[model samples]
Target: MDELLIRLRNPHERERAFSDMVKKYQQSVYYFVRRMVVDHDDANDVAQNVFIKAWKGLDGFRGDAQLSTWLYRIAHNESVSFIQREQRIAGISLDRIAHELPSTLRADKHYSGDEIQMKLQTAIALLPEKQKAVFIMKYYDDKTYDEMSAITGTSVGALKASYHHAVKKIEQFLRGEE
Candidate 1:
């Protein structure tokens, strides 16, 4: 990480460093975005935006947080912003968005999930936005609370409660018990 940071901070190595950074982080970044947006095309666009933003802003980056944490923060903000923009432009309700996900996931050529995985995705889609973020970062990404707090700007206590509630809700959803 320190080596990557040094490369990123060097003008001569900046482009190569960014390429290396993308190679290292792109899959994780895309998966993180996909978990948030649940649509392959949308996630692809947003993930691209994240990398572009990172490239543009890397020179100004101070070494406060780990690079992965910084990237996650960008991805999170971009995901929420995209959702909000979609809601405004299309007037799509959250329920409608969630309702549309299964069909999209099914139609996506990239998707290869089994029935259980599909069901789990459906349950995840049903979560409220913040809870969904908390659930994805914790359950899928396995990020610690402090890491999530850095990414989400939520307090650690709130993130813990959110994750607890998110897990219970997901359990209830998967069990067909509302």
Candidate 2:
């Protein structure tokens, strides 16, 4: 890890470090952003921004948290900011997307594996922002609750509650209970 940090600290080794970081975390960041935005293009854009922000901020990183945790916090902030800006410009609430999902899911059978995935995505999209953040960091990023708490600055109990609430909401959504 120290060797990697040394490589990361060198300007000439920046490309390799950046590439390694991207390779290591890109998918997690992409999916986390995608869960928030529900748009592939927007997710891609936000994921790129997350990496860019990380690269710029790398020198100042004090290693207080795992590098992955730090990157996730960046991704979370970028995703929320993107969603807020999009909501203001489009006059559309992310909530409406959740409410409309059953119809959308039923309409498209061509994408077989994706039907359930679409429902799942819709359910995730419905989560309150903080709950969604915790859920994504915990589940999608495979982060420990402790890491999630640090990244979100929420207590472990709160993070656990948020994840539980998110799961219940998703289960209800999937079952057509809500």
Candidate 3:
């Protein structure tokens, strides 16, 4: 258990500790959500929700995992839940949303990626949600399989497989094969 975790668990010190934690983690959390959700505003809302959940759930956090791993798990859940809820409310299928992302990316002023980067993001957006998360965690975040498993509640073997499939799909998409 780290000092921050200890402080977070301590009711007396929790508020200050959580503030510190947020400052340390907010950008990473926001970017993580941003990669998944695409839109800046949507990612910001989801990131806030992630922190809100973290604040409410901090006391129940056991010291079995690192605080970052725990936070990533929360972030993964919140991002996936946000995507699912948006899909339902918009009455759009995952495939539809995925297809729509390229145009959306083109119009997003906040997205400053180059042409190649935009193409890469479009390929990533075409992935299934779990595979997309796996790809982002490994490629962008560089999380180890153990860390990814802790964050995603997935077996290491499955994570490896998912990463492999996501890579293949991205390759195919980039090559204009599918």
Candidate 4:
């Protein structure tokens, strides 16, 4: 990691290093965005924005966090921004979007989930951006609260509470209690 950072910081190696970093993190970043945005094109655009931000911010990076964490943080911010923009433009909340996810999922060629998976996704989509990010990082990525804290800049205790609430909400949604 240190070697990669050094290479990234070196002017001569910067471009190549950034490209390598993108290659290493792109898929994970895309999937993270995809889960948040629920669409391939939006995920691709947001993921591209994340990498662009990382590249532009590379000189200021202090290496206080792991590259992956930094990238995830960028991804999280971009995803939230994209969703918020979508909500504003469409004049629809994520909860309303969740209600439409079934048909959206059905039409998405990239989505291959079954009925239960769709239900889970819809439930997740209903969460506020931060809670949804916490849930995805914990439940899907199996990220530790500490790791999530670093990525989200949230306190571990708060993240835990958010995760707990997110779980309860998902359970309720799945049980048709939402």
Please name the candidate that would achieve the greatest lDDT relative to the true structure.
Answer: 4
Candidate 4 ranges beyond 4 A from true positions: none
For model 3, residues 1-178, the per-residue Cα lDDT tens digits are 7889999887889899999999999988998999999999999999999999999887688879998888899999999898888888999976777677778888899998877788788888778788889899999999999999999999999999999999998888788898
What stretches of model 2 exceed 4 Å from their correct place? 101-114
lDDT of 4 by residue, 42-144 (tens): 9889999999999999988999899999999999999999998889999987668888999999999999999999999999988999999999999889999
In angstroms, give how far residue 36 of model 3 lies from its true place: 0.5
Estimate candidate 1's alpha-carbon lDDT, on a 0 to 1 scale. 0.88
Give the alpha carbon lDDT tens digit for every residue of 1-178 in model 1. 4799989998899889899999999999999999888778999999999999998888777979999999999999998888778778999877786677678778889898876788788888777778888899999989999999999999999999999998998888778898
* Cα shift from native, residue 21, model 2 (Å): 1.8
lDDT (C-alpha) at residue 176 in model 3: 84
lDDT of 3 at 157: 100
Model 2: worst 10 consecutive residues (lDDT sum): 104-113
Best by TM-score: 4
Model 4 scores worst on lDDT over the 10 consecutive residues at: 92-101
Once fitted onto the true fold, the runs of candidate 1 whose alpha carbons sit more than 4 angstroms away are none
- Residue 140 deviation, candidate 2, in Å? 3.1
Clashes of each: 0, 0, 0, 0
Q: What is the TM-score of each candidate against the true structure?
A: 0.93, 0.85, 0.95, 0.97
List model 2 lDDT by residue over 52-171, tens digit each. Answer: 999889989887777888888898888888877877898878778677865755664433436678788788877777788888777776788888877788899988888998888889
Q: Rate the local accuracy (lDDT) of all candidates.
A: 0.88, 0.80, 0.89, 0.93
Q: Looking at candidate 4, what is the lDDT of residue 97? A: 89
Q: Quick one: ranking by lDDT, best first?
A: 4, 3, 1, 2
lDDT of 4 at 33: 92
